[model samples]
Target chain A: MAPMRIDQLTPGTVAHIVAIDLDELGERRLREHGLDEGVEVELLHRAAFGADPLAVRVGNACVAMRRSQAAGVTVRVAQRLEAAE
Target chain B: MSEVMTAPVVALVGNPNAGKTSLFNALTGARQKVANYPGVTVERKAGTLTLPDGSRAELIDLPGAHSLEPRSPDEEVTRDVLVGAYAHERVPDAIIAVVDATNLASQLRFVLELKALGRPMVVALNMMDLAERDGFFIDYEALARELALPVIPTVAVRRRGLEAVIAAARDALNAAEISAIRSADAPAMLVEAIGDMRGHQRQARDIAAKVVSGGDANQMTRQIDRLVLHPVSGPVLLAVILFLMFQAVFAWATPFADAIEGAIGWAQGIVMTSLPAGPVRGFLTEGLLGGVGAVIVFLPQIVILFAFILVLEQSGYMTRAAFLMDRLMAGVGLSGRAFIPLLSSFACAIPGIMATRSIADPKDRLTTILIAPLMTCSARLPVYAVIIAAFIPDRTVGGLANMQGLVLFGLYAFGVVGALAAAWVLRLTVTKGAGGGFLMEMPKYQLPAIRDLAIGIWQRAWAFLRRAGTIILVSTMVLWVFASYPKAPDGVSQVDYSIAGRIGAGLEVVFAPIGFNKEISIALVPGMAAREVAVAALGTVYAIDADDEELLEVELADRLRGAWPLPTALAFLAWFVFAPQCISTFAVTRRETNGWRWPIFMFSYLFVMAYLGAGATYWISKWALGG
Candidate 1:
């Protein structure tokens, strides 16, 4: 219903980027890797340690970034895929 | 047309993992030249390509970049070359913009950015096989018309569509004069595109939405990542992979290393009997064979290590490994990017130091380079082996591990701990700045091609061998001259009378506080050439006349046991664990950092660590053992 940080999205949840709050450089880098407003993304995986870094599927590509970087991106949930488990 | 003319330059540009390098390798096969761009450590990889017309074009592989907006030094090079701003590199007469055919929507964003420059360009829709396998179909004709550039589907790894791609490139070059006139209005195109990435993305998405239909790609990658990045299984698999790689680096490479050593020894033996026993013979056996040979012996290990690194990188597992190690390395203020370079340091710091180029943040790369030598490289192995054999007893400790083996393991552990500690401190001080963030793309995994692996390993091994031939060769010869000159008087030992001996005698005073003897002091001089040479220098200083290799080790070990106390032996091991003794490492650091500044700082800090580490070891052992 509301925009959430990509880091806060549950695994298997699909979302579209609403806006990026990172510094100019970070935002530019994220956009260059196909992360931009209205682009569909899915939360795919989180690293083992503390889950600080996350892997998000941007378009057809997978991007790994720390939570700090991912927190800058605000996204609106589109749908939650059924968990196989 | 028949007249001879300079080859037109065609540059291959792409985003990372777009198969640009594989295409370059396939087209230029074995004609590649990799060198550093002038005034920067970024590599310049160029090769000659034969056009379908039997004419040649210089195909330069520009460093992969996401956009022309310069974020890193590598990106700056790519952007500069594309915009005709880099002074050292020629402007490409035609550009081949490589994009992944599987995910054209995202990759076309970069191709759209490249089109703004208006260079006569062809679009290489690479990885077409994967796209087809994943159930994607594209109207290449429509895509070509939409972009106003020739779009050629290519499977670069299989050398598919190469001739057509080259023929298109030749046609683009033929149309370059007209394109140049068209580019008259495209001035400062990069500046405008930098601020309008959203526009490019929208246009690229529009183009893809108009002409492409496909099922979900990268499904296989997602499935594998499920297990490979699982909370429990991910780290375990990473650990297993790393352990196996290290094992392969050491165990699998041992016989090849032994063969190389045997060949050098055989060469030395021939020189020994063929030449008269004089300066000429001494120089050949000691300087040329011993100095260069010792460094060359590590080639097998480097090749093995690189074979693993190249595979992991090509298979896209390297990024995953970096992702797994990120949080742990973050404890030391380094991103996970430092993990591969630091791991490589165990084989040899040269490649490890060079590998730091992957790190985008300057401070993070600097910190990694400074701590790389503390990883207890394979050169330190022979020194540790000799010292551990001489002092540590053969008896078992804890009823399972041999005492010597335990000590050897401890030395490795010590080096790793010391490296982490140094990194921690350096991050707080010299390399302190904005902390680097871990932001990487995890590409779909594919089997590494055997040809690419061979080329990668060959390039690294050749760089190492070149160092051995130049810097290592020179330093060894200088040390040999110092060690051999002014033969001893009738009674005095040759080493005691030589220039190196006198320097050792003088250095002994400075080293005495750390419990180093005159023989150790003398060996330290030649050790600057390489760590392992210290062992051979010690043998000569001890005046053990054993010609056979096994006899030398046995007699030298016994002699060391009788001559030095246990504390000194332990101290020797401690010094090597931190000492900056390799000149080749310094040379590479200078080349990497582009000056003497960082290498000087590295040398100074490491010397201090070695002094403190050795002194502490000597005193603690002496007091603990009542020696």
Candidate 2:
């Protein structure tokens, strides 16, 4: 259960969205973007540059978020997995 | 079907932070115009896509909204456009609802609402990469069956899944089942059903379990945030970043600005040598070259300024800075929502005013609009550069930072102060009700795409050049005519009897109390078009008959210091801080507010403040100097 930075999340990993430790503005933005409790997300890819903005698949769409804000979002690794073919 | 006859209109809608912009940019390529301003999109941006059949499909990116219920003006606009409530435009033929793949439950709520609208609709599941990393699996088929819409996974930044999105849109459009919802049955049952369904959140969970897969948290971000977000370190980091921004503006832009100046000088030399000594030569040299070149020389500074802003915005640090300033902004009657728009005002006020639509409270929005222009914009950069270069001694402060850069930072600080003070006063007098409460979202930080960042910067630079070429061009020509006409008597200086000089002299009677000379008065008149135009106008007016290649900065300073006192120089700078001068800003204010009353009040109040502020600065400077 090592606490990992959001940017290191790779595609195909499943984690629960724990919490978004952001300012009021950032908090509202997180809610607006559908990053809340009970929601599971998958890391799609890091943007090309070394910057922290990443694309994550939430529900039926992929959205980008900054690494700093994502760091505040705590998540537990999902246990369920598809059997290797 | 005669598919080639008419283009299909495809509307893009999504909750904020749903990667709609990335998707739009991916689809439209270089055809985006940033309809309103940075950080906020209000108007519909239309771009055409050539279908395989040679029929064109028009793609329209609508403003991001949380719900179709429409809480704010921006949301209402989205609702109206979707509902075909707009007076001029027809309803879109197809809807592309972009949803964050990781945050499906809430986003699906909006999709369900859109489904109820009965329009041909498809869901673009953007940010699939992030979803996989977070270990969320989405069963597109199950979700599609549940919502009864085509679902496509997309990584907009990577330009992935766009084809599927387009194909789904095409399929939806061709199907005749897409029609407006006209059920006479009350929506109360649907609302109740939705409320009840929330209890079975497992519906979304079950679908997600079926489709999405593989997301593991990375350890690096956690380790870094511990140090960066530390209360003491966070502010320090922000300060360091800002210091670098100003330093870059001066240090990096000097050589480029000098190159442009040299080029303009070479062109001016050619015009003087080739053209006969007549009105045409004077017009080319003084009016066109002097006026335009003076403004263009500052282009490097403009580009560099945007470079810093764009990088910061893309890095995701800007939102953090705004978050830090939220408490402070609230003390001055501004909501957290005002931060983005006000930050944008530093580049231009038109878009800043338009960005106010995001503020739900009319009073807060109006107050934000009124004070936005007080923020120092790119247009004010030339004037500040000229004045600072002329007056402020260029020495290092604390043996580390350049004194000139600090002064430039101070000028920006002064504008922020002026905006806050105005907002405070307006809250008490003009605007009614309490300021809107803060509710903002903080998106997870991810690396910014270099291509998108580059495109954003280029767009800003293009806009700056367009303004310089058109509005500044015609105004400079007219200024030349005014300052060139009414030839002086045999012995009198040519400018002394010219139309501009006479007008300035008459106006000086009023401005003299604040220590401004006739020339300064004349220049201030055209400053209303834009602040930087005043610098160009001054160059043209003073260089009307000059022959030497001496630096314009040194010459202008010498002339001003000889004709007017130091108090006047200081007073003029103070006036700019609160000046109700930019006519274009006022026009934008009128458009944003949809009335003349707000603009009129803003203008009159700002004029009084500018006069009083300048008058005060003059007296203080005079006393300090013992003049």
Tell me the spans in candidate 2 whose CA falls farther than 4 Å from its real position.
A1-85, B1-4, B33-41, B176-229, B545-564
Give the per-residue lDDT of model 2 (tens digit) for B1-627. Answer: 335566778889997777887788888888765564232346557777555555668898888887665658888778777777654455678899998786666666667666666677888988888777767677778777766778888999889987788777778767733453333232443354334323334454555555556544433333444444445575578778877877888889999988998888788788877888788988998888888888988888878877777776655566566555555666777765688788778888877787788887789899999999888888888887877777788899899888878888888888888889898888888886765555444454567776677777788788888888988888888888988887667777666779888888998998888777777788888878888889888887787745445433344555555556678877888888888778888888877777899999999988888888889999999999998
Best by TM-score: 1
Name the TM-score of candidate 1: 0.90
lDDT for position B607 in model 2: 85
Please provide, for model 1 over B395-440, each residue's C-alpha lDDT reduced to its tens digit, 9 standing for 90 to 100. 8788865676667667877998898899899999988888779888
* Segments in model 1 whose C-alpha atoms lie over 4 Å from true places: A80-85, B1-4, B177-187, B344-358, B376-413, B529-569, B584-597, B621-626
Docking class of 2: incorrect
Each candidate structure's count of clashing pairs: 0, 90
